[model samples]
Target: MYQRLITSRHFVPLLAGFGAMLCITALSSLGSAVQSSVWLMAPFGATMVILFGLPESPLAQPRNIIVGHLLTTAIGLSVATLVGVTPWTLGLAVGLAVSLMMLTNTTHPPAGANPLVVMLAGEHWDFLLMPVAAGAILIVVFGVLYHRVISGKQYPKRWF
Candidate 1:
């Protein structure tokens, strides 16, 4: 049974977990060097799962990951700045983010937490550029490389 599990592709998830570990570690290292870069965001863990564990999903696409994080974070920053971080505004931000993601055809579920993260932290505009935009972009890039080199799989069925 143990040998069957090992050789029957049951360890793919474990392999993906290792990939996640490497990716996040690289991000964290860069984030430490770059003061403005916050590559270790909460939602990124979920992003890693989709990227490494299920890279074939549409949500794992580069466009989806980048645009979803950017759009959601923008909405969060806007709502937090203009409407404040009250309960209703928080809901409003997340709703708008989801709706906009659907409208833009970039529906990455993990990015949905951007509003809460932004509102709760009261992040400035730089947050959109650093962790939201840049971190997401690098994550996608890492996912692509990991899939090709380590997992021997195709990723991102589409680019746009």
Candidate 2:
């Protein structure tokens, strides 16, 4: 029974969930003692799902996750500061982010929401550095370590 359970198709998925839990818990705890820091945002939950559960996917690549989040957030912040967040601007921001992500070859879908997050949350320029850049960097680092140490697999199939 134990061997069968270990070899079951669902075993890997269970492991992935466990991995995601650990990574998020670590990220959350590292935030302010009050756990109110932007260190863990909404999109990060989806990011974790991909990072831990589908590390082999191109969208889960470190470059994609980091660059995609940074680019979209920058675009959103710029638009929000300059034009403002009307329905049109919101669509414009997301469209531009998608197009640019495709062009840059860094299309992490979860990051597709960063623009909306920024616009709605009224995040300032500092947001790009804190939760956007810093958080993405830490997530990628932790994913690398987790996959290498726990899964015995190299994450990011390709660094480029």
lDDT of each: 0.89, 0.87
Clashing pairs in 2: none
Scored by lDDT, model 1 comes in at 0.89
Instruction: Give a tens-digit lDDT track for model 2, residues 43-131.
Output: 98999889988899999999999998999999999889999999999999999999999999999999899999999988899999987
In model 1, how large is the Cα lDDT of residue 68? 95
Q: After superposition, how far is residue 70 of candidate 1 from its true place, in Å?
A: 0.3
Q: Which candidate tops lDDT? A: 1
lDDT value, residue 126 of candidate 2: 91
* TM-score for predicted model 2 compared with the true structure: 0.91
